[model samples]
Target: MRLIRWLVPVLIWLAGCLVVGRAADGAEVMLPEKFQRLLPLHEPLGKPGPFDWLAHHPEPGQTFGQYVASRPVVPDRRRRTIYVQPLGEFTEAQQRIVELAGRYLRIYFDLPAEVRPAMPLKLIPASARRRHPEWGMEQVLTGYVLEKILWPRLPRDAGAYLAFTPTDLWPGEGWNFVFGQASLRQRVGVWSIYRFGDPDRDDETFRLCLKRTIKTAAHETAHMFSMLHCIQFRCAMNGSNHLAESDRRPLWLCPHCLAKLCWATKADPEKRFRDLAAFCTEQGFDEEAEFFRKSLAAIQGRR
Candidate 1:
């Protein structure tokens, strides 16, 4: 079954492609063509460098049609809230970013989002914690966080349960460290702000940290609904093997991926763009704000 791929332990960080091609299950999904209007406003994906995720892990990209055909997880009236669980202590600035992420998720998905009370790191056992042999940075086990800590506490009303931490994360042996990790079926995911940069730094660095956190948070949450990476355009869903590549990726979803998000979340693309543009403007993301404004205009048939 196609779900077998998702059931297997898979960890997706802020990550993909524009293949409006056949789905693995070969089921067809009728998509609205309105999203096609935004194509002129987007740029195609550039060639990948040797260290980029595409260069190493070439994937058959999923389109809006394929995504819907897959019968992805979607929010329902009973299970419509996104819960942000804090796993460790965070600085005041880091806490602010987490709160903002929750707000952004609420706006981005048109779902209610809540930031839960902080959970002590002491709750994690020694078995699930480790110190990197080479880097000497203490790290948390991503698998343990998902299965052990998050699974048991999964709230009945949660569409997605995401854990935020300040520690580095590692999936398992042989893997060095991960920016974050999420399960496709589990509804639980975790990411660290430790490497996102010190938000306590100056204003520029704070904005940078905020942008990275928001990107990762939104990207990982999307995976919970089975949205794949976009190879079709320069998009928020594109994968990155390293920080540089991720930094280069825009904070906007491509038209194809945007279609998937709107379908999955039952969101209005026009309203989503307006909300995003407003948020970006407030956050001093001038370029992204302008792009979203243009996207809004394009979709509305405004010249």
Candidate 2:
């Protein structure tokens, strides 16, 4: 079954090549045509299941064209860096995850991604802190972190100012907790590692936690660039109602969302895939590395 899951994308890539032929020199065709050839390599999203995110949110998804038409935020010369602000306390292992996440963001967006000096969580006032009535877990207000803490400190050269905390977060009074939250226009966001599991537990758990943290970090930062939740494919940009749904999402973007990232950040598709593959390989994300390798091969007309 796992083999089949892996082979399906390869088969799709082959079929896409037949449908959209390569040039005489085996180079990919021109701009949009080259991009179009890659689209069918990704599977279209099917109907949402009972507990799926779309079953609840029902978003009208954005396409690459729509994304461009929307005049989505893109990094410019004056605002080109992505900043990661560490909030509260992190274990040594947890801090490693944060550092890796920053590295991933750099390659993911083809931008400078740096972690600022750690900021004290005491900055979040007592009024913004609470204990979950049912679970008794300590929680911090997501809004306060974004608006009060991060927004004010957003650097002039920052394309996105992101905060990562070891603390749990609740969006407001109604919600139980959020894995993360971002302001679409403000270019600032916050995510919690509290729910991603303990990195010190075991190797498997460590990788799992690292993967989840990077996913949320990259996903939320993409939002700051004005990319909407993906509904077209099994992509990293897909909305998630819970951990199971989130875990089901791919670590790589589908072609459509990839185009958005490329367009917004002026990233070279081939180089982006290569860099991501290298990072995943170094970090022991074998499956994700394989997928990125395939993406690089597909784009380079090697398969």
Would you list the C-alpha lDDT of every candidate in the order shown?
Answer: 0.87, 0.87
Report how far residue 82 has shifted in candidate 2, in Å.
0.5
Per residue, candidate 2 scores C-alpha lDDT tens digits across 105-176 of: 999999999999899889889999999999999999999998899889999999999999999999987899
Model 2 residue 146 lDDT score: 85
Structure candidate 1, residue pairs in collision:
16-229, 16-230, 16-238, 16-239, 17-229, 17-230, 17-231, 18-231, 18-232
The 10 consecutive residues of candidate 1 with the worst lDDT sum are: 11-20
Would you estimate the TM-scores of all the predictions? Answer: 0.89, 0.88
lDDT of 2 at 261: 91
Pairs in steric clash, model 2: none
